[model samples]
Target: MTKRSPFLELDGVTVDFPIYSGGSRSLKKTLVSIGTGGRIKRGGGRISIQALKDVSIRLGHGDRLGLVGHNGAGKTTLLRTMSGVYEPTIGRVRASGRMATIFDFTLGLDFDATGYENITLQGMLLGLTRSGVAGLVDEIAAFTDLGGYLDMPIRTYSAGMLTRLAFAVATSTDPELLLMDEWIETGDADFFQRAEARLKTLIERAGILVLASHNLALIRHYCTSAAWLEHGQLKAIGPVEEVLAAAGLSVANAALAGRQSFSNAQ
Candidate 1:
């Protein structure tokens, strides 16, 4: 029997963002640095940030991978790289199957457009055809329950209303590979339960799920494997418990230690 190909593969993938340290504001200066592989030197009046450095991972079908790290540890950067929003400055990323990402739910929405119109706009931005988006409008509108507000310009909606509209449109479609920065929880208690159920269903339906989150319990519950990142490098990758333990976040071990301490005191 032959082995299956990876649904997602990253080998030595690095991402760089230019830092203009009081240098020329000209496009030419920035363009010149794009191909330099994020190199920085003293007195250059320019700097480059290696947001991800030589990060590698592989995920086949049915894999739920969690990413754990401190802030500015390249967790979000890696997710953006996987979603094709950020191209790797060096090395490569190969992803098979259709990919859908739920990061920044309000991104790409037109404030001037009506809620219904923005549904078509956001859906198209997600790689759906016009007809494809049209088909989803009713489903999204029903899920959002915006009713008359759906015909009003998005700018007129309150912040919570806008969030509802965005979440509805985002989760309306399914994809082969799903990427999320963090678990999305919204609304009051009544609505949060509904959102939680929808989120659970979405995760269950995806072929592959890569989630970057700070919630250790949530990660352990949903992810089959995990990776720890620090300073733009992968510190560890393996079973969820092993990776979490290596990252000094052993929840189970800590609980056990707490019990032992209490017993000794008794």
Candidate 2:
């Protein structure tokens, strides 16, 4: 049987951001950096960051794939590219669904707007219509329970309040594909418990999920399959158990070995 094409494809994607040493010269420095290494060394920086390089993946209808990598190993970059936040410089991407993403450094809130207003703005940005956003506004505000605070500007709210409101809105949106950089774990410990329960339900409702997380237990328990990312490419892609073992993260063998060693010592 032939396998279907993934809903999202990152075909040998590569992206880079330029680095410059001097900031004051502006357009004048452009000429200097192009002509000579000496000028560039003096005015432009010697190094640059390659955020993503020749990375590729395919996410399908049934894929609950976990992305594993060290920090700066392109995990977040891959998620951002897939989410349309960062376009690939050297590759083609084909996407075929409405997406909901949560990697918000600050939950992408606007300070000038009320929690109620910001939810509508962000929801529309996520592809919802006026009524679609309106219908959810009440639900979001009620769930967050900011109460009269919902009428106040977001700037006046606490960080935890902002996160709660942001998460409430983002989670309430029903998207075909869900992209999570890190699972939502914000606010006080009490709020965290509620967020986790919501997360479990949200994961079940989505058609496909591409998660990048350092929490292995959550990855293993939730993902139907797994992909191990190292550097800028996939190291292993298969059934959750097999790929995890190939990544040297399986705990069964380690536990058995420890038991044997302990017995021998006794």
Q: Report the lDDT tens digits of candidate 2 across residue range 1-266.
A: 56444388878898775665575347666665565534534424445567777877777777788876555667888888888878887897778776778777354578999878888888876678989998888788778878999889999998789888888877887666788876666759888888887887888877788887666776787898888777767788878888878878668644553443344222
lDDT of 1 by residue, 53-131 (tens): 9999998889999998877899999999997778998989989787888888888989999998999999988889999
Q: Per-candidate TM vs. native?
A: 0.84, 0.80
Prediction 1 TM-score vs. true: 0.84
Candidate 2 minimal-lDDT segment of 10 residues: 257-266
Off by over 4 Å in 1: 1-6, 27-46, 252-266
lDDT of 1: 0.84
Write down the TM-score for model 2: 0.80
Deviation in Å, model 2, residue 238 alpha carbon: 1.8
| RMSD of candidates 1 onward, in order | 7.5, 7.7
Clashing pairs in 1: none
Clashing pairs in 2: 21-44, 21-45
Instruction: Name the runs in model 2 displaced over 4 angstroms.
Output: 1-6, 23-25, 32-48, 105-107, 250-266
